[model samples]
Target: MSYLFIILLAAVLVYIIFFRKKVVKAAEIAGVNYDELLDVHVPFYRFLELNEKNRFEKRVREFFREVRIEGVGTEVTDVDRVLIAASAVIPIFGFPEWKYKNLTNVILYPDTFDGEFQFEGGNRNILGMVGSGYMNGQMLLSRAALVRGFSSAAGKENTAIHEFVHLLDKSDGATDGVPANLQPPAFAAPWLHLMHVEMRRISAGKSDINPYALTNEAEFFAVAAEYFFEKPRQLQQKHPELYASLSSIFGQDPADGGGR
Candidate 1:
């Protein structure tokens, strides 16, 4: 390669090595309170064995170290930090090497935002949103909904996970609901067919999933991912094929008590 290219590559390698050391040190400092917060807010944390818990904690530490979480119109507490990190950690915990490289910032608002992304005005019930175009690599979450999403034991609504899933769905260049690169080649036809079937069921009001999933395929994927993690057993029972597809996509089975 050219001398300039070699120099740039060396610089990148140095940065990666140094950054990892910093991340580990940061994790050491922040991970001590991981269990404490998980005990209070994360129901999924209770099911994991010691090893899994350790792994989850490591991932959480890494996530917090890598991403920047800031609050708007409110103070961002440790509970908020833990919950936000947990939301990100849960979805990709199966893959140890996986990191949300696309997500650089998480902005939490005091409550629901409006169309203009302000705290008040039209309709005012936007829970979470992943940035696109010029605002890419950013996420916005409602503090109230973020807490409620983890506090609730039943519903399959998680603002953090929902937005993170959208982030994952967007990794392949478009958020069309199909994470084409992540799915297996054989999964292509079956996945599309399942989406159609599920949409039909939802339209007929025979499905228990949120009707908002019907908005589009991208939304369907995000909402389905929320259910896949929150109420895995129920989702599996109601939509076995969808569950299986998600299991394959995520490389983990939450229905099996969150095992990879």
Candidate 2:
């Protein structure tokens, strides 16, 4: 029995090591040129610098290596690289466990992609989806939105970060915005309470955050995350309590660049 146990343990160790290496390799193949990434978005350096402060920086690099960008139209110029990097990093910032794991592919359109949906009445129609951050495993963004977000430096309404935040929220099997891993016993009450209060305020138009956050809890979380990174000062100034709760849940301080 003891020998059998040892064998099982060894097998588990081997699997972990092998799987992790494969992930790293995949990431390398998918990563874009560092210089190209910088040229497209000047803020990319700041983000990279921030990542350097945390032990997770190396892992973040590896993760990017594995991500592939496809279906981007001609509108995707060199400048769009920053959006790609921001989309890749911001979501993982709140969930470091995603390192070495592929979050699937990112499909970029020139701007907002036309989406078609079928109504219950059997009528099929297409609608223009225009937004900075739209996520469903596949993240869609407008090139103009990406530029505005980076140039602003306020970080209050980053579409890439916002959409990816949704991806993180849905990682645990649901899009409810409450990431399961973040729902520790200690945080349960505070997260729920703050979310409820802030969401209500936004709905009432009493908050500076986008009113779309009032759509649901999941959206509340994603929109809050966008403000947390893009517009930290504004979010803190307007919603101190909500900012504090987010700081705790994400395990890092955007105000301080803890995880960058």
Scored by lDDT, the top model is 1
Per-residue lDDT value at 141 in model 1: 95
Residue 172 in candidate 1, Cα distance off native in Å? 1.4
Mark the 10 consecutive residues where model 1 has the least summed lDDT. 23-32
The deviation in Å at residue 51 for candidate 2 is: 7.2
Model 1 backbone overlap count:
0
lDDT of 2: 0.60
What does candidate 1's lDDT look like per residue over 17-80, in tens digits? 9887777546434635789888778877777888989898888888877887878899988898
Steric clash pairs (candidate 1): none
lDDT of 2 by residue, 90-203 (tens): 556556556424255555554444443222234423111222234433555555565666675544667666666666666666678677766676776668788888777777
